[model samples]
Target: MRRSSSFVLGAVALACAGPDRDAAPASPTSSDATGTSGGSTTVSGSAGTGSATTEAGDTNGATIGDTTGDDGASSSGGAELGVPMFVAQGMVGRTTVSCDDGLTWIGERSWDVEGDAHLCGSTTPVDCSGSGSTCTQRWFDGSCSEEACDCGHSPGFSKGVEHGAGRFVATWGWGWPGAVATSTNGFDWQTTLDGDTFGGLRYGGGRFVVASRTPQTSLDGITWTASQEADFHGDDGVTIWSVRRFGFADVDGGRFVAYASGDTSVDTLISSDGGGSWWRPRSMPSDCLGEGPGAYGDIIAGNGVIVMVDGDGHACRSDDGGSSWTAHTITDSRIASSGVWTGDEFWFWGFGSRYSSADGITWTTTPIDAPDDIGPVARSPEGTLVAVNNVWLGYEQQAFLRSTDGVTWASLPDGDFTPGHPIFFIAFGHAEPSAMCPGT
Candidate 1:
C-alpha cells in the first residue's frame, strides 16, 4: 500500500483579503487505504469510507483463482447474495443491470430495442452468443450490426445523484422525451419523470436541479418546476454558442456552482440563493477554453475547491468557489473526460489512462489495463472504484474493472451483466447494505 500525502489550500489563504463574510470551512485531511488483494481502495469522508481485502474471484462465478473456500463459498462474502446494484438507461431502449456485489450482475432488462419484445420480458442473464443477440449489440454510430448493436433510442448521456438517505434520482436521454428514474435502495427503481431531456442532474441548496433545455428544480426529485435558460457567456462579454457539456457542484453554505462548456470557452454560474438565481463571477482563463469545435467537459467540486478538466488535458482550478480560476497542465494529454473528488485527491480517467492529483494543481498519470475503451468511472458505496470498459467500439463485449489504489485493477468475469453492450452511465447509490465502508 503506497500512501501519498495531500496538500490542501487553507480557507484563509484562499479567502480574498476583503470583508470577512461567512464562508464554508475547508474539509479535513482525507485518508485512503488500498488493499493489495482485491484492488479496492477505501476512501474516508462524509460520504462514507471503504477498505480492501482479499476476495475469491470475479462476482460472475468465473474461475480466476482460489476464491471459493472448501465449502464452495467465497471467503470474502462477495459470492453471497447481497444488495443489488441497479443499472438503468443504456444505449439501447429502457434497459437496466443489477448487481449485489461487483462480481455478479443480472439484467439487460431491455424494452423496445428492435421494435419487438426481444430481451424485454426475460430476467435471465445476458446471452452474448447467437444471431440478433443482446450481448453483441451497439447503438447507431455508423457501425456494423454484427460487430455492435447499431440501434436508435440509445442514451446520449446519463447522470444520477443521491438526494437524501435511501433516496436517489437519475436522468438520461438524447433529445426531448428523456426519462428519469428514482430509487430508495439502488435496487428497485421507478420512473418518475419522462419527456424533456436533461443534460445533468444534481442535488444542492436544499433542492434537486436538472440542466435540461431549461433548468428545472425539484424538492423531492419527483415533482419539478422549470427555470429560465442559464446564462452562459465568455470573457469577451458575448454568450458562447454551441453549449455541449453541463455540470454542477455544491460549494456548501447554501451556495452552488453550475458550469456550461461551449465551442469557444467554458462558462460558470454561481447561485447564492440555491437554484433561484445565478450570476457569473469571472471568466475562466484562456487556457481553460475549449480547443476545437464541439469540444467540452465538466467541473467537479470537493474539499472547498472546484476543478474543471477538458478533453485537451487542460484543467482549471478555483479556490474561492467559481469566482476566479487558475490553469494547470496535465502530463498526459489524452483528453480527460470525467473526474471525481475523492475527498483526498482528484481522480480523472479517459480512454486509456487514469490520472490523480493531491492538490488538483499537479497531476500524475497511469496507464489503465482495460480490455477495451474506458467509459464512466465512479466510487461504489463499498468504497471500490468501478469503471466501465469497451463502450466505444462494438468489436468486444462490454465489461467493468475495479481498482483500489488506481494503480492496480481487477476484471470481473463474464456473468449475467458482464457480457453485454457498454452502458453510457454508471453511478454509486447511497443505500449501501453491504456496509463496505470501513469503521461504519
Candidate 2:
C-alpha cells in the first residue's frame, strides 16, 4: 500500500503473451486497459456516451499551454489517455532499434519485485523464472502477513519479435483474455492459450492464426484447443458484443479471410482449411449503408486485397471475397491491431493517424508527435512500425514509449524487449491538449 500518485491506484492484474520473444504479443485490442484515473470530469457523446472514466495510459497532465490545472506533473506525458505517443531514448542503454516507422523498437523494462528479492513464485526460477515466459500473480497486502505484493512488472506490450525455425510467438493479452506463447530458443516458454490473441500473430503461407474470442486452436504454437467458440449472448439472450478475429487479412481462394464480431454484426470469417475451418459470418457489403454502433479492426491483407478496419476512421475494402466492401481513409478512429505486408503500401494505426495505406485505399496521415498518447495499432514481423505508449503507474517507473516514424519519439521507461511482446493495440492518444483543441 504505497501511496504517492495521490494515495495510490491499481492496475496490471494479469497479462499474457509468451513464446520467449519475451512479451508483447498477447494481441487483440480496442483498449481501456483501465488505468483508473478517478476524480477528473467531463466525457462527451459518441464513443457510446463516454463517461466510463479510466484515464492514465499516459498522463503527463496539462499542456498546449496548460489546461485546467496544468502541472500536476507531466512533461511530455500529459494526454495519451487514448492516443498520441512519444518515447525513444536508449542507444547505449535502451538498445533495439530500426525505425522509419517500419516498427522494430523493442524497449520498456521493469522489475517491481519491491526492488531487491521476495517473489519466489513458480518455485522461484530466479524470481519469475521464464516459464511460458513469465506471468506470475499474488498481490494481496490485506494485512496479517498476507503480503505477497509482487509488482515484478507486467505491461510488456512490444511491437517486435520474429523467430523462425527455432520458433517463438507472443501476441499479448490475458486479463482481457486472448493469449499465446510458444518458444523454441527464445527461452523455455510453454503456456499456449489463455485469451484474446488477435491482431499480431499471423504466420502466413504455412499459416498460424491468433484472435481468440472463444475461437481457439494450436497445432504447434504449443498446445491449444477450442477450434471456434462464441457466445456474445444475443438471440433470446441479448448481450451482443461479439468480436472474434477482429481485422486485416485477405486471401480469397486458398482461403484465409477473417474479420469478426457477431452480435453487433460486420462479418467475414472464412478459413478455407488452413485455420482448421471457419465460415459462418458475413456482411462486408450485405449492402453498406451504415449501421448504429460499430467496432472492427485488424484485417489487412493488402495488394492481394482485403482491407477492413474500424473505430469509424474507415478503411474498408474487400475486392471480392467478403462479397463487397470499399471505403478507406484512416485519419483516426479505433484501429486496434494492424498489419498489411509491412511498409510503403498499407500501414494503419489507431489513436488518430499513424497511417500509410497506399493501395488499401488512399491514406497518408503519419503524424505521431507523441510525448505520450498512443491508443491502438501494432505491427512487427519485420516491417517494424511500433507506437505503443500506455503507462499508468507500474511497469515500475518510466511508463510505456516507442515510435519509429510519424515523427521521432523514444521514452524507454527503463528498457525491455529481448523476447517480450504484447502488441494488443499500439496506436496512441492525447491531442486535445492544444488548449484542448480548437485553433490553438
Poorest 10 consecutive residues of model 1 by lDDT?
1-10
Judge candidate 1 at residue 37 and give its lDDT. Answer: 22
Candidate 2 at 286: error in angstroms?
20
The local distance difference test score of each candidate is 0.46, 0.35
Off by over 4 Å in 2: 1-244, 248-267, 270-297, 300-316, 319-322, 325-355, 358-423, 427-440
State TM-scores per candidate. Answer: 0.64, 0.27
Residues 48-141, model 2: lDDT tens digits? 1111112111111111121111001122334323212222211101112222232333333222322211122223222122233333332223
Highest lDDT against the true fold, candidate: 1
**Which 10 consecutive positions of candidate 2 have the poorest summed lDDT?**
63-72
